[model samples]
Target: MKQTRKPPLAVVQISRAVTVIRFHVCLLFVFFASTILATLPSNVLFTSTAGSAVRMPINIIANQSFGYFTKPPQSDQIGLYVRDGDGRISDAMITPQSKYQNFLGVSRRQRTQGPEYAMIARLVGSWTDCNRGAESCVEDGFRLSAFEIKTPSPMPTICGDALITSETPTKWAYRDLVDYQYIVVAMAHVKVDCDSGVFAPDIQTRADGGE
Candidate 1:
């Protein structure tokens, strides 16, 4: 019987090297693919209808009692600087206009007088990185496509339910005028000019009012 010949050691070694090279090439392809995806823009258009459920809860209230107000109907964007109970601040944007004008109206009233209000709302949008040289984009923040306020009804009783007067019987505390848990603030239509690293709005007002 003829003896069977084994493959040469050099050939076997070459085969192993080729397998290792193939594995590394596959790894490199995946790494580059993921990097490219990470850099792609993720701006989502706001399309939430009225009464829609809140999807992503930001769990925050406006840091400033005043200054942030609801945008007018003609404006296309709403800018906010919101903070959680712990006081962690973040930049938020409400875009494409306010679909829930009723809520915005309520907020406008409460905000104009100067009262910090909490919100229970859904933030439907993408959280993108700050622009290259944006001064106000202090931290990576949310570019809200939709904001839906969901303040619980039959307001909490911790605060006096009746509108309490501070200065006079006819004068009511601005904070007591509305349900703090469900009021709106900083819902204005403002352009986010991160390219210039400025927070300049086309219009400015002393009295204020989002989701």
Candidate 2:
């Protein structure tokens, strides 16, 4: 007796169907996971870029605290300075009209409109804008304080967690994360000028990112 063989077309079609099903199953799994993550609290979802289980609920408390302590908003000129871990300092002049001032109430100085002013504004805004403001100064918009931004070092943190060391060596701690590259200390110093008008030294400490 002769045995019957399966058709080549049938075999090929079956194989293709299996592969397609697998691909779709994987896609669905990923989609469902991402949706669950989106529903979770920011702190929990943010714990690990990929992990699903979270311990803390994400909240705006930290940001709210910053806004509370920062000086009240006002209109004026702003000075920005940046110092790298290498100790190099760069400066930018900003006023209520400059397009690139990142902090609140900063923009092109009204009388000093020019390409340089535009360039400086762009640079400072790109670095940080914790103070909050739109690009380029607009009507009724207050300017950032020059004293708040003119320094190379970050603003000092008088409170919050402190950095300490121990005589006996111990495992690195999550608390020690304050030294993480992205974490920075910044100080805002504001000054009023009759010529340049009011400005602030906004100090920023940038993240090294270990790159």
Candidate 3:
């Protein structure tokens, strides 16, 4: 006697539906986060009811002289990198608010103030807690292709700046300045889909933090 096998059409359909639902959920999360992120304070970048939060160890440098140095730090220091949905790297320093806006191009028509920039800014402010003034503040003069990853998040932690030195001889280069300091901020954004995603087909601003 031969046994007959039946097709799992119902199971297949159910699986497909589940996949679609998951994709939608992810899409919704990304969209909501991106929109609210731009308007939110850096302190509260990832506090959602969904119970997903990423704690990044922002490098806090205190009471350091500000100037252009020819040598890298003797000891390891704090640095960051910014990336977009396409994984393209930007070698911009976001320590100062002006640099953040100008180098990252947060204002005007040519700026790449994507998720990474917003995240970095928020983190820098929170790390420094710069309420009174620029004194005893935090600034990221060092350049990093990536960070040390002391702790990892379930979701990708979008860095506002890259913190590795392999890519560039110098992570940060100071112009003819002798008494300037700034706090570093960083962030990143990943697209759900390019062909049918809402955030896709978007253009990043092209400002080098220079007016």
lDDT of each: 0.32, 0.33, 0.35
TM-score for each predicted model, relative to the true structure: 0.21, 0.19, 0.18
- Candidate 1 lDDT tens digits, 113-194: 2221221111112233322222233222223222222222223211111111111121235536633212221232212212
Query: For residues 101-161, could you state the per-residue lDDT of candidate 3 as single tens digits?
Result: 4555454422233343343333331122222112212122222112222112212233333
Better of 1 and 2 by TM-score: 1
Candidate 3 structure, TM-score to reference = 0.18
User: Residue 105 error for model 3, in Å?
Assistant: 42
Candidate 3 regions exceeding 4 Å error are 1-7, 42-211
Q: Tens digit of lDDT per residue, candidate 2, span 1-211?
A: 9999867998999999999999999998876565555444446326434343331232221112333455543323333343334644343333344345534435324335234233223333332223222112110112222222232212221111111100112124643643221211222322212232223334334322211
Q: Rank the candidates by TM-score, best first.
A: 1, 2, 3
After superposing candidate 1 on the true structure, give the runs of residues whose Cα lies further than 4 Å from its correct spot: 1-3, 43-211
Selected candidate, larger TM-score, 2 vs 3? 2
Q: Which stretches of candidate 2 lie over 4 Å from their true place?
A: 1-7, 44-211
